[model samples]
Target: MSDKKIEAEVRQFTVSADDDGIRLDRWFKRNLPDASFNLVSRWARTGQLRVNGKRATPGDRVETGQIVRVPPAETPPPTAAAKPKVERPTLTEDEIAFVNEIVIHRDPAAIVVNKPPGLATQGGTKTHTHLDGLLDGLADDAGNRPKLVHRLDKDTSGVLLLARSARAASFFSKSFSGRTARKVYWALVIGVPDIKDGYIDLPIAKQPGTGGEKMHVDEEEGLAARTRYRIVERAGNSTAWVELQPLTGRTHQLRVHMAAIGHPIVGDGKYGGQDAFLTGSISRKLHLHARRLRIDHPDGGQIDVTAELPDHFAESMAYLGFDPADGDLPLDEIKFSETAEGKRRAAEAAAKSRRKERKGERRSRGNGSEGGRSNSGGGRSKR
Candidate 1:
């Protein structure tokens, strides 16, 4: 047989600091935007793509400074370049107008937008219009589409960052992964916090039965979660304006933590039930707003931005005796991270609680022998 023909040229790329903690598939999407989602997945499963020379799965997380090898995407043969490049999909007129309206700041590396509430960052079921879908409108003449480096809840409005290129995306992703991105959020709570400035250390986990979007505090069966909050203003005893800085990124951490402390975030019906609504002048819209964001830029500078409150949030603030100009609160002083050991200890405590519950169940059972066996200490009867 003749010598085997050559395959696609394999290329190696070193993951930058900003690209940390991203899934392999996401990495491909950021770096090779032209490649189909299925194509990158196929390369991973077939061993054409790899991490550090070893075969890896698509869902595998790639850390900062790691090397990822990608096989050449299927392209036309050598003479293909002679043909003109095909046109890219254009954004709808509405999307173009929307992108233009939300853009607060833009540069070579990133575009910062004041994302409005009720707009989902990424698309989902029944979500036809989303920020990410419309980001294509911001693409340059070269067809380099902007990418979302982070996300915000659908009902939470404020400063949202988008990376204009793969390099910038990596930079911002690393900033979030390394905990260097300082985020401050403002919320009008149902009740006043007794302590003006304090920390809420609670373990949060997914609720037992429901969609994965739900998060609840479970001492034993949860991940470590912590939030630092300061009372910005008090609207008498009924409600208060609070500024919160989350130390850990857990699903619904803020909503659950505030609820656990007996002061649920105003308008958060999912956690506070009927109590979420404040009847009178206060609107029933969730009062959470991502007020400000500060992070390092990819090109060796810093980006600090503040977003104006949404209409509902501003109205609630005014109604609740909060001044929109009270921006002097300290935001970035706290340095906190929940260690792996702490989370492990919390999980152990939950496991211990489960074991004790099982023992109690055994004791409560009608079977005397099972109850005795579970509750009994030493085998022999003590004198």
Candidate 2:
């Protein structure tokens, strides 16, 4: 490593409301553009970086009015090698037309595409022709290709958002990771759930021996996962069209959760086994569709866009005697505090409070202390 001298004075910044809820590394990229991510991470790892006088990590969220302390900025030598630029791949005419055909909405900062089923978002082993490979078709005159902010499953059809620039990508990425962006999905399940509308607070983990290609519910060593599902219309007791909202983002979360409840999503044979397929004229394609996306725009206001269902999903719905119009339900903003897990937490807290009260009473009786002053200055906190 080359010896580099750092400046003596430390830099301090107060978090702004606009930058609130963003990651610490992103904060540096926005305000201190000169500081590279490597430098910020190094500062954090070595305990040179702090937030509100506490050591912080790059993933830490910053709140408004919080003080962020940074070590002295490092200046690289003038003779340092310049970083190589990523070459943008040239796209064929057909590739550009294909990507453009899927574009349902486009703005200065974002591009919303109705990605069809069977198309992988990004390429992997044995996967070449994917959405990411063709993203060069969406590049602008400056050769800046739109960046994918979120991804959908290969067999899932829906609205996929893309950022037009690096700055927009950072902003949109923060919006998604912070869980401020809302996604509404429509799916057809094998059977109707007993509860018309309820939250599925089941933890999920990757299944063993699947090479991380599959997920399953693992209560012991799984990540907290929650999904809110509501039955839209039932075709007798056989099948039901449902609206799904994932409270937490996990790989194949909706598919895994539905299958765990004995009502697997239509055509998801990987998780649902043989029962995932339906009889009669119903199509065997995956019925899950990302119907709508509502997110805060970096340019201000909100970008609320809906995607039209694919031909297979639409055809399946028609064959199932369900109206396509019924799938266009309003997407409401939901809070975790209103979920079943939230209620359970509240009950536990109340029980703990009662237990503490009883313990205090017993102690007071044993000590014979009378006329104890009660503290009644409790104040509610606002999120």
Candidate 3:
């Protein structure tokens, strides 16, 4: 067979002394903006990358002031790309105020915001206002709309991370999927657990239901989940301050595991408990909060971010006699405009009215009219 040969364009660069023993992939990524680690390693494996004109491996140590040559492979032609048309939603006066208040830590890589309860991370069919929808308005710089790398339950408020770019999103997503990203949560449960500082190794499975899919702990046919918890304080006979670290990223893993151990979250309605609803014991809102996260930086470093507890969570802490500022918890300012507060109050009033209506029906039935509206008085039983 005739030998097919293609000439390679060799590019050379001298390594600085400071980068004496850095990984070859890292060094190439720093120098070549378009080349990724996979490309570098592939070229190295094919003897296309050399040190001092000798074939080199991707893991070879580079001494200071050594010349490295990378042979250029056949580069693919750039494909036609379209600029994404981003639709920025208009925020209400209250939403603008809320967005201005909740941002705790922000950088070019990621943004950590204090997500208030009742705000969904993404939008649904009936959801008009959501965190992702409002991100373009909350960005620090123009044309840098942030996007969520992960999610939090609508009722479970606290720290939420948003990636600034698609690159950052991919990097952070990998970090979370690999379990290298550290996530910590603060919660107030119904009762104190038996173990103060230990792990709950359980499995969670999606419960078979019609309305909304909820999670339940099923040891037999469920995915393995783990949560490490520690008791921060004991609050009366019914509530306890707790910190949780989820080892696996399952849907509702923490909520299901805590409820499975006889101590449900203060305001989780899906699980079986009296205090599940917001109108129950916890009056304010759900007690779960994502407090902190630690992640690797895309620029060869690590970043530690913390989001403060919301006002309602702080109120719960006060009710439990604990200081919110006792530790390094970041405090964020939240200002609910009068218009927003009015809407919220109206919603609550409507919910209360509906509950009263249901209660009235139950009481009316107690007055001895339960037998299908009494056929003696009805001409033809409306059916």
Candidate 4:
């Protein structure tokens, strides 16, 4: 390892207010502009960042009035010892076959693949095969390594975007951040929404008083979030096919919002009903897919890409008595409530607990544990 050191100062600010309560590493990237998000994540894992002088976890919230202490980075010294070479694994024939079958649309700026359910978009620790790993062999253009610009859940199949070059990747990233890219998702949801078509306008805030692993609707403290949905087909009395467009990007925003309104998407384990994983039901694979994407092409034209429905989605469509080739469906306007009661309850409970703890500490200090006290019943013993 190479030796390097970095010193940082403590700051008084809240991560929740700044990021609408995003993950700690994401918040660090926004605040410490010079620090790489990956490096910040490393620091978090190694206990280099602290909250109120105690080591902090990456998921811990930096609330208002709290002081955050960012410690200096400690880098190990390099040695002259020879390093062992590690071999890269070759792709299996089965993996190659899967990649060869998924290409639906391709262009100079972007490539859209019909991702099958259970295939990961990118690799991580313990991931042996992923879309990126298979790309070098599948690309039609020689010497080009396709890069994924956005991600789909591992279990949710459909359209996945890949940028052919760094320039294209940057352009698409900006478009997504600016809310100019149009992403349409297809899902089979439990029960039809009360309204035919509408926008969900709820503001999304991270769950307060806990680590920032969950999000909830909070009108006062949450960031503005919007999603529009329209019913595509009614699959009997219990389920309906719908199209979704998110106006704001929040992690798992669509799933959470849908569940909040009593219409969770089928097969969604995190937010769906109890029987979500059972076979022979609509709740087996989350039934959600990134079906279409429309964006201003990096090469100066509009590009619209689509992915064909996977086998499961097709089976559900046929079961619902809807033709898979239908071009248009009625659009509905669904709106979400600006405020959610759950978030308010959490915030209030947090405030109350903080006040109680402060009071208890004050009493403890007054009761004398300061320097030294005579525990043995002596007449005013001094240390």
Best by lDDT: 2
Q: Please, what are the lDDT tens digits per residue for candidate 1 over residues 139-245?
A: 89897778787778888899899988767776787667556678889998988988999899998777878766687889997766778889988877899888988
Top TM-score prediction, candidate number: 1
Residues 1-383 of candidate 3 have per-residue lDDT tens digits of: 00112336566656532234455775675455356678777887888888878888777866434667877544455784634555466677787677767888877787788889899887777887788778766765566577667788888898888778767866776666555677789888887788887778887766867342587877897655778787888866668888887766777888998888888887776774666533333454678999888888887787787778877778778867877555343322222222222334468799999999999998888766655556554747554
Error of 4 at 269 (Å): 2.8
Candidate 2 — which residues are off by over 4 angstroms?
Answer: 1-89, 336-383
Q: What is the C-alpha lDDT of each candidate?
A: 0.77, 0.82, 0.70, 0.67
> Could you give the candidate ranking by TM-score, starting with the highest?
1, 2, 4, 3
- Over 25-54, each residue of candidate 2 has an lDDT whose tens digit, in order, gives 877876675677888889888999999899
TM-score quality measure for candidate 4: 0.63
Task: Sort by lDDT, best first.
Answer: 2, 1, 3, 4
Worst 10 residues of 1 by lDDT: 1-10
- Every model's TM-score: 0.71, 0.70, 0.60, 0.63
* Model 4 worst lDDT window (10 residues): 333-342
Extract clashing residue pairs from model 3.
none
- State, as a TM-score between 0 and 1, how close model 2 is to the true structure: 0.70
Q: Per-residue CA lDDT of candidate 4, range 292-330, in tens?
A: 877779989877777788887777667667675662443
